[model samples]
Target: MFGSLGAVTLLVSAVLGQGFATPKANGTSGYELKQGPLDTPWTEKVGTTPWPEYPRPQMARSEWRNLNGVWQYRNASGGESEMERPPFRQELESSVLVPFCLESALSGVMGNYTIHSWYRTTFNVPDSWTERVLLNFAAVDYQATVFVNEKQVANHTGGYWAFNIDITDQLNKNGTNELVVFVFDPTNLWPYNVPIGKQKLIPEHIFYTPCSGIWQTVWLESAPADSIEKLHINAGADGKVDITVHTTSNTTTTADFILYEPNSELVKLKIKVPVNKAHSFVVDSPQLWSPDSPTLYNITVKLGSDAVQSYTGFRTISKGVVNGVQRPLLNGEFVFMFGTLDQGYWPDGLHSPPSFDAMVSDLKVLKEVGYNMVRKHIKVEPALFYQAADQLGLMLIQDMPALSTSSVFINDETAKQCPGVSLTPSLDPDTVQKEFDRQLAVMVNQLKSYPSIVTWVIYNEGWGQPWEGNDGVRNTSIDGILTDYVRKIDPTRLIDSVTGWHDHGAGDFYDNHHYSSPQCGTPWYSTPSSPYNSETDHRIAIQGEFGGIGQNVSEEHAWKVAASINAINNTYELDATPKIWNLRAHMILQELEFQIQEYACSGAVWTQTTDVEGEVNGMLTYDRRVNRMDKDMWRRDIQGLYEAAARRARTNGTMGVEGRGGGGG
Candidate 1:
């Protein structure tokens, strides 16, 4: 059977292809690889079986193989011989681990600015899996081309989106089959407007290192000829959930669903539904989801012999007026949102997290320090990240990773130092808008099922896709068009078209970014005026980003934190001691109280979650060992401010004016 491999299975690819070549000896030709400062318990166990856990936890299957270790790699230029192609014409130069980017030390190839590379691996297919076998790659940066058994199978573009290929016909059932992948990532290079968020050709203060090649999990899954390809579960505050199942077979398919409350360990109910159609069910006295109590329903969908597991939560996200000011309503009640700017970068993995536990630890720390929300700034994390947030009761604001070859820099002195020049968009490549729209659709369709995601951020500081007019006037024409499209696809969540600057008077929030010296100040809009034109009326005012206080930790614990940028300049002064940091936290908590009590702001996000590269303004060090701020002060002072704000919003004369549990309709 396919699930049980025979002992005849060869562990290496040398026996499969006659032309397959061996890896060059270590340190003979490849780049000098290195490791990060901190390592989880799982790091030492990452030998022939790195990241053995299932990549897609939401929609999961039992019979799958993780292909994430010891892939032969080669670096070649355009002028190299044709033998450098796939199916092993010669021995590769080195070996690297899969799912880890090339720029990362964990990948075993710590090279930089590499434009082209190739990977080779081998797998065997059992006789029972003759129906169909699917090859899945979670993400590959820039461009990728694949070949199986010396035949080209698929080619894909775009960095963040996932793609799959059906390779049943190309497999060798009796012997080890050869798999080859060629990747080319021109990060921030000319002529390509790919989405690379905060990745620059030259590393600096804010923008850090770039990643390339397969930065996510690679796996093989076996399924019946007719199976469920995609499943969507949308939960509402009215205790109703709409389930849609997309199947490969066109004939009428029936699927059985079993619902269970994971926390209560109680079996709720069971039902059968038709495939490829909307099926709705209403529960009695449903346990709603919120920051205080997050309730998830475990569901299993079975079609024929193929089965997959998933989950969803009951909640609603909308916007309305509270105390004569517009704000977000969760489950139809005004709730204050306190968030942090999460860049999702790891000291070792770069774009990917070191492990699932590592990712959860960051969220746990944020929750411990009294943050209820996180703005996932300019990056689309894996599905499991959002699923964790749904189960943990943390809200998320997702930002689209901007695309272009230009830069968008804004600081405390941006408005004062550069008056007219601070509001311009980067140089636009003609083909980028189309690619961005396609990626946007993919992102929404893949992630809209999560109840924790309350808002979608279209742009950030105008890094790449910004709108500029012929007469040099800033407008919201393009932003309005994009927002309309997003609403059509997903009207359930609110949209923030442009987060920091270039407010085209569009989207749901009057988003602003301020990093002045005092670290705690609120803006009051008496006339409701827009930054570009006349009075604004549609969106609620919010402070998207602020408070970037730099503090360098001891070199013994944080040596690699400043290695990438300050390689030569080692003059970083550690002026922020424990007392200074405590005072800083107190000032920020006082500011948070002021913003909530006096200012009419609904939400505020701190600068970042962890330090990255040379930017040492994060609450935690890059290795996640040290907490830069005072934890006791945060829980005692900052957490109370958020709770007080929510109380004020609830009792400010808007209760029972509208239905408190209505879904977005």
Candidate 2:
């Protein structure tokens, strides 16, 4: 095999022209790569193919295979080789790690191309488990075709949603079975490339390196012919939680739900309900979940022969008048959400984290820094990320990866091309809006159960939305349609219809994104005079994005921050050799305090959680190595801002409603 220690040494020399001793993969069935910059403990502890933990924590089954180690890979572009036998191709070019993008260094194949990348591996089914075998993929970029024993089994066409194939008939009972996958991601090559978030083939400013092919986990599970497939558990504030189970078996089955507090004693209780019916359980004196306490009740549901583990928190989100202003209420009280934007990117694992612990570490930073929410900008993270957020008591504002007729970059060039327009993707409006809608529905259904997700952003600056009328202006009718459509699906959370730029007077909150200098003395409020304000419609005010204060890390790693200088005030310089890192740090802290304490702000999401590729506006660096702002100094102020919101709610006095807006004016 080409993945042995000796082969690793040879491979490293061949790839990077460097000779180094090959280290063993941490107690797993693969070789570890030579260390890269920004490697975390999880990155070092990555066993075999990185994400070794259970991929799906919300619906976790113990009986599953982690098919995420070394696999034979070859560029399937006009290669003269056999595609139907063992090893697949006669001359397999290289070995790549499964679930990591080929472009990523962690994958062991650092080539970044959009052509068909064929992945081949073999796995044996346990003889004891014999009813049915299912092959699952957490996500594959663009499109993928699966083959079992050289026979086509299934095909999927979404980059952000999970798909599965019932390979029961395709599996070989006697010995190991050959599995092959072909993936083609056109990226922004065509109009109908699907919503790829910030992926760009040419990778410059905001658009990042393209994450091509399987960027998540691939696994196999065996289940009874008739068994539980999916579980949707919605928790409520009234000491009750609702469970809906989707089963594959038609015969009678009972769902046994066991509850625990996740402590040393492991105290437990059980509730049994019919598999096909919706069941509700009243948790007597349930401890409500919040960012401060973060209380969670563990749940283990067993349906016939299939059992999965999940957890839920008793919390609710609503909109009402508070302190004479419209605000988002948490558990029936006004609570301000203060957080940063999380892109969920890694230095090694682009979309996928280096390991489960690595992903958890990102959330732990937010919890420790006194943040209550994370606006997941334009990326739907893996299930475990959400599970961690739930357990950590961090709320989320998830954004739909914007689709487009063509590539649209949010830049000054775009601003000039389409004046006064925030989002405009239609060169010739592609007919893939249906696909975007389908993926949106999938995203909502896939992540609705997690208690931490409090909002869904449908159209971000009108990425690939309809431009039917008014010179690329956003159509309020379309905004209303999408808002109502998403509301029907999950009415538990608030919806930000069109974040920033265009405002259609729809959705629950008026979201605005600004990067201007802050007014320190004044506490800004959302009034009817604002651009997004409506005369007839009433919604809460939220500073969706603000304060992108750029600070140069160093001369070697400051290109992105230098480029971002033009986006802010003219007074700010593009100092390539900036010596004072503390100057920008002071400005950022003061601006953040102002944004968080704004009189009319119910929530505020800072520019970002970390510095992405070139945009150096994150609180943390791209590698999760450095916190630009001192944690101890910022933590107290951040915590105090949240406390202020709660204090205002308590002392809110009577005020006459002079306008249509909800609470604060």
C-alpha RMSD of candidate 2? 8.9
Instruction: Give each model's whole-structure lDDT.
Output: 0.70, 0.68
lDDT of 2 at 310: 66
Give the range where candidate 1 is weakest over 10 consecutive residues by summed lDDT: 1-10
Global lDDT of model 1: 0.70
Predicted candidate 2 versus true structure: per-residue lDDT over 418-446, tens digit per residue: 22222343444435767778888989999
Q: Native-vs-model 2 lDDT? A: 0.68
> What are the clashing pairs of model 2?
324-663, 325-663, 325-664, 326-663, 326-664, 403-464, 404-464
**What tens-digit string does per-residue lDDT give for candidate 1 at 50-163?**
555566655676566667766777664541243354645344668877778887777778666656778877777656564678888888986888888888899998788888
Error of 2 at 371 (Å): 0.8
lDDT of 1 at 444: 80
What's the C-alpha lDDT at position 405 in model 1? Answer: 42
What TM-score does structure 1 among the candidates reach? Answer: 0.85
Q: Return the top candidate by TM-score.
A: 1
Model 1, stretches more than 4 Å misplaced? 1-45, 79-84, 87-90, 126-130, 264-266, 405-428, 516-536, 557-575, 650-665
